[model samples]
Target: MTSPALTKDAIRAKALELGFDAVGFAPATLDPKHGERLHAYLDDGRHGTMAWMESRAEQRISPDALWPDARTVIVLGTNYGPRTDPTAIHALKDRAAISVYAQGKDYHDVVKKRLKALGRWMVEELACQIKVFVDTAPVMEKPLAQMAGIGWQGKHTNVVSREFGSWLFLGEVFTTLDLEPDRAEVDHCGTCTACLDACPTGAITPYQMDARKCISYLTIEHKGTLDPDLMAAMGNHVYGCDDCLAACPWTKFTKLHTEPNFLPRVELTAPRLADLAALDDTEFRQVFAGSPIKRTRRNPMVRNVLIAIGNSKARRLKEVAEALSEDLNESVRETARWALQRLEKP
Candidate 1:
């Protein structure tokens, strides 16, 4: 086995060679403060309909608890910044705005594949035992990345890197290898409330977030009917909302992602709400292949499209909303009916 000291630098060099934008190391430990805050968020019913967040509380906050044998965590970041302003779609009110992250291939798949390859290299080259984790695992990746000096978790609850801004996807390799830990990055969000103020649903509150009111959570994770007030306030954001992310001044450092897989699909970049609202199950599956939108299934997506159509200033979408009134998905049909009613009013 290679000496622990020598392996740390080797691992980092290999990570960069593997196409990861940033990599750092941290000792596996529990984040008690984050745990308490998460508990409070759940206790206050702030997670909305995301019951799974409460169910996995223990695993979410502690790395040692996730895998007791984990000694070192190698955190990796992949940049997915867009080439243009994500909010530009708002000018075309008849279109739906999908978050930049979901505008390309799913990060979980893309990041995980790279992580697994790195894990294999560690085993063969360093003779280390390791486990790879993306969002699929119970790892608190943002906090781990912060501890590894990749970046600090800004008040918006996302990691902010100097080079990549807040436009990176994080993954981890929890290994039994005793690697040197990196210096933790300091928080640079002093007195800045731009992200908090920009949130359309007011989800951000300093270091905390009321996930119930987050448009991303409401539109994607919250499975049932959303409150009419929240739906109305969502504007044209049909999938996930990026106001908090886009509002970060740190993003000024961001450059367009080099990964071809992350480039925005022509159809998804600014898809018309009329076309999206018209997707049946088969059409939805076909349109969203390899995209993160497939995760929500046709029902939620179409429902969101109807909500966007309702909020659209374009009078042309009235017919689009009317056509969706008979959608096969009851949720889609219901939201379409509501949209048509709102659009038809004088």
Candidate 2:
């Protein structure tokens, strides 16, 4: 007697039932062509201070190289599209322009918990070896996502879905099950420079990104004083920037995510720059307890607030910027000096 096989449709159904917005599968044997691109990007020093991306370049490009036993890779997408226009805060100079993705609970916790649920289900039903990965791993999720038909990597270098637009949070599950793969999505962004023209720092060049000039990198991963030109271009974005992502035309199709955990907290939407600048380490930790902003630390965050105030030309924040000018951290003080100069300009 022949038993029924575990089908791709069945796996996808289960994944969707588990609350993953979109799901697709691809062979673990993804093409290694991206490895060459990674080397070129790193060699040009385009990655800037993100040395970790360079350190794990090998495991990042080649899925088979990362895990030999993996035969199928299940790629998942969770939409974190904003309930409101992400760009609206820019006009409110006194408020911070936090990236929409970070305005809610951390996706790592949301997606990883869901991945574990799906993985455990597969292990019991199909009896396959499995591994789950969030962004913590060296996985090239964007390329792998393109391979799995989740979406095409758009001009901004983010996976853009026609359905969810540029708001998908990606996760991957590696399994020994040899399920049929989905057909890859072709590049749909034809002659559209919306994301490119919209970048405040011009980080996106056609399909390639210069992470050195990227505002997200500047405000997040970057550890020291921002370049003078980059600081001027940063505007009021304190934690991360989303100009490119919000500019994608496909975002019109995106809907507000219904998951309670993914919903934006009221305070993160457009927090007062003065309030943020006043946050001590203890207060900062308490306010951003489960938030991704906590990783940016006190000094850099304060540095950003001062810069935003300087750019706003609000006389009130001059005192705040003045106080931060003598901050203990050299980077913070450097930014504070720049802010003071911007404010002091006649």
Candidate 3:
């Protein structure tokens, strides 16, 4: 294997050729205060049911701990911006709002494959040892991307690139290759409270997020019964919520995704709550076959639909709620009972 010295520009070109929207490099080092802040956030019970987050405390802060030989951290961003505001479905109150990210194929598989291809190309061309990650490991990808100059961590705590907005999914290539690092982007979220105020559950606070109060966690990561207070506030969001990400001013620069797999499915886009409420296990698997929504399985999804039907102003969904009252899943049954009560009142 011939060792050709790899420059950051050369790597960026290869990344573009490989279909990544943005690429940036950073030294494999930990942010001094990030660990402390993360610990504080966890200590406050902010991570909710995500026990995995607390388990990998050291690796989350130090990239070197993940792979000691990694000299350069190449952060890649793939944009998944929708053609329209995902929140537009809210007006159709009888429909369930799926987060834009989950409306398409799971990004984990899509991004990891691309990163592996890029890594293989790098190994063959530059003779570098590399490992790829796409939200799979303990890597604190957002801060690393910010440090690498791919983007800045906006008030919403997600990476926001000037070129791609907040709609980009982050992936990383940890390599032994020595590469020049890019200058970090300066924070551009000054005076912007749109995302903070837009959160239905008020999950965002400065640079922090309380996952316990986040709809994404409640509907996805959370198992068993949900807090009555938060469930009532969930509105029609059946899966993940994107209120913060969608409210960012930086999204003005967002463009339609080039990946065909990311295009919203007709059935998923503002899916009628009544239809979702009717999904048995088999139908649920078939409908969400290639979608990220499959992660929630049938029970939680039905539970979410019940919550949405309860909140709906559509009289038609009242029967849907009543029908789900005897759902096999206890959680779904309880939520359905609540929905039935709400629908019966008015």
TM-score of each model, in listed order:
0.96, 0.97, 0.96
Q: Write the per-residue lDDT of candidate 1 for residues 61-150, one digit (tens) a residue.
A: 888888889999999999998889877787888878999999888888999999999999988887778999998677888888889999
lDDT of each: 0.86, 0.87, 0.86
What is candidate 2's lDDT per residue for 74-186, written digit by digit as tens? 99999887878888899998899989888889889999999999999889887788999998898889988988999999999999998999999999999988777888999
Comparing 1 with 2 on lDDT, the higher-scoring candidate is: 2
Clashes of each: 0, 0, 0
Return the clash pairs for model 3, or none. none
Candidate 3 TM-score, true structure as reference: 0.96
Q: Tell me the alpha-carbon RMSD of every candidate.
A: 1.4, 1.5, 1.7
Best of the candidates, TM-score: 2
lDDT of 3 by residue, 1-346 (tens): 3333445667788899888988888889877788888899889999988999999987888889889999999999999989889888888888899999988888888888899999998888787799999886999898889888989998888888888888999999999987767788889999989999999888889888899989898888888777777877889999998888889988888888989879888888888898898999999999998777887899988898888887776677778877877777889888988887777775
Error of 3 at 150 (Å): 1.2
lDDT (0-100) at residue 145 of candidate 3?
92
Candidate 2 residues lying further than 4 Å off, grouped into runs, are 1-6
Question: What 10-residue stretch in candidate 2 is worst by lDDT?
Answer: 1-10
